[model samples]
Target: MAAFTDSDGTCLFNLNDGKRELVNGAEAAQALVDKALAGRDHTAITRICLSNKSYDEGAAGAIAEALSKMTSVTEADISDVIAGRPEDMALRVLAAICGGLAGRSLSLIDVSDNAMGEKGVNACRAALEGQRETLSALRMCNDGLSASAMEAVRDLLVAGDVPTRLTQLHFFNNMSGDGGAKALAQILPHCPQLRDLRFSGTRAGRPGSVAVANALAACPAATSGRFVSLDLADNTFGTEGAAALATVLRKQANLTLLSLRDGSLEDEGMVAVANALRGAAPALRSLDLSANDCTGACAKAVARAVASCTKLEYLGLEENDGFGSAGAVKLAGVLGGLKQLQRLQLGQCSIGTRGAVALAKSLEGLDCLTSLELNGNAISEEGMYGFTEALGAAGKLSALGEMDDNNAEASEEEEEEESEEESGDEAEAEEETEEAAADASVDELTAALGGVKM
Candidate 1:
């Protein structure tokens, strides 16, 4: 039930005495469009998400129509849908409509996880180029389109009437290969206002990666645009590619967040990065190296490097191919050493009870951690218990997840260990026992002296 509610526990869409009934995507979209046109005194529903829902025919078109009609709509998010091939045609229509609308203000439109083929993507590019002022954030992630489609997207970006507020553009997990990325990187010099770019799971190879890195390296600080975010997850950027990119990062001081998660960053690549950002990029705050085949040594090096960059706050190492129990322990040990660490992501790292215990110990020493996302791991009941026990011992915590019986048992063990504070008394009792033995021996000697011994 991903529904929004008001202060009175009433659903936002369930207003107006139940006059607006929307059980499906089409219905909801139609209601929103109709309501906006009629001035029905309702909130703007242009920003919508159609996840885990059924849809009727031409649902995408209906959504696009509602979005196009709303002049005040700033975003439209409808991910994980299987709109038909005809959906692209509808999207084009919406794009045309968005271009023609005088008061159109739609800035974002997310249609990710929809296997809209190459054709659909072409339509998307056409529409976006046509309505550049109104559309900025476009998410076509997790779709199936060849490299050519991505190139088309790049070409469309080059088209005139481009908007400047286009900050985020996510096309990750799509099969847009190197050719597409090349096309995109070519436009980097032109897009002076682009801030965030996500290309994870795309075939952004050495050539494409080099193009992007070069573009970033050459981007001047005085330029109106800065690549604040760069996500290259699940790409095939080996050491050569990473080395080239690392060179760019070394010089690109304006980058605030850099994510190489799922990229083919190996030990060599890690070393390259370690050399690159040792002192450069002082303003960097977020770095994600997840799913990279980097071992504990690499992670330790990374942590050490980050420790020097005092402004860094969020570091993600989840789902790495080489981070094991040893790696987790090393990282946990260094956790408190970092003074500005606020958010840490270690999801799916195969952490066990020992790793959990180490992390708990680290948490006990820290006072700044705000949120920790530990999903999809082997953290059994014991791990959860250790975390809570540490929280209780530390006397304060931002937030912690649920704990099972095993966690409770671990906590009890910790409490028991804490209660044994009178070790001096036990030592004194042992000394007294030895003294009594000596006294008994002396009494026997006295008895023998009195001629009363057996």
Candidate 2:
């Protein structure tokens, strides 16, 4: 059963324990609120979770009033509630709730996965307008927010009493279009302290993407080491959008992380990203371009960039069908230069025995690499054996995933035929066969290093 609890694991409200009635109406919500208010110990309850509940406008106002009384509450979660009240009443309830939070210590608010119509957006804006000084994170995912709502949020950030105070903002699965993106981009200059901006599955097309990139590009160098983290995953930002983002990235030299996973980025987009990374953005420590359309040529460009950025520590290139033996070889050539790299994910990239051999050879110099994922590849026992031997020599890897057994067996059979046709000495062939017999699966390679799952 799920329950809301404090930091010490004490349950404040056991929703499914059957000891207390479920909060489905104004009466039940008022009971909880009254109990907390009577005790005058609202600090004991830091999280307000009324998810999957049913209530009315009266309950919402009561809940908001109860929240206003709490002094130490930091997070509020009112998601997925069926408020059987008029739209205007709901708006008033939301407004009251926001008004209550005006001078509180609240920092994070989540009103996601609800049918919060247009008025809900205004309520959110009003709640945030006064709490801008304290609120650093806001999540309104899938709240049926429109471009007008986006514009309102932009104004809240740029024209509010405490602008540039927000650090993280999430707007996933919304209905914002080009106008919304443009509005958000216009406020980027005002929010100089922004750290994380996420917009997954928001359909921010090329025009919208370029607007955001342009705004970010215009920012001065971050006083801190990293400028900000940008996540645009699951958005259909096509090649044009990718190019625009690449241009901005080249200009923004202090960006620490960039994630464009599962986007519409193809080989051309990757080439642009690679160019942006080469001899620039030395502070960039992580880059996630997984599930893109990157191929061997794209991998070659990444290799050049990786060789130039010596401080890069994480690179995720998983689920790309284009990274083959050629890409692996190119990647292997640059692995030695990335001495600080700790995690490299290249799973399901179609790397075969030849590519594995090149990668294993390069592992000889990567002493800092702790986790490597190579699953779903056509790696043979021989190829895996080479990798295990390299890991044993370096003694740094802690996790390695398994390879395709069927593909490994087929490669082994072919190797036997080639061995029989070889014109090498009998003793040498016997020695090689003995070594092959003692070969270990890639999964067993991490037994000596800690047993870590990648």
Kindly report the root-mean-square deviation of model 2 from the true structure over all alpha carbons.
10.3
Listed per model in order, the count of residue pairs whose N, CA or C atoms clash below 3 Å is 2, 0
- In order of appearance, the predictions have TM-scores of 0.62, 0.69
**Could you tell me which 10 consecutive residues in candidate 2 have the lowest summed lDDT?**
13-22
lDDT of 2 by residue, 145-228 (tens): 777878877766666434566677778888877777787777767665667787777767777866776666664323332456
Model 2 has how many clashing residue pairs?
A: 0
Best lDDT goes to which candidate? 2
Per-residue CA lDDT of candidate 1, range 206-296, in tens? Answer: 7676666566555442143356777777676778777767766666567788888777778778868866776566678888888877775
- The regions of model 1 sitting more than 4 angstroms off are 1-32, 37-114, 130-136, 159-165, 203-211, 219-225, 251-256, 279-285, 309-313, 319-333, 337-360, 368-454
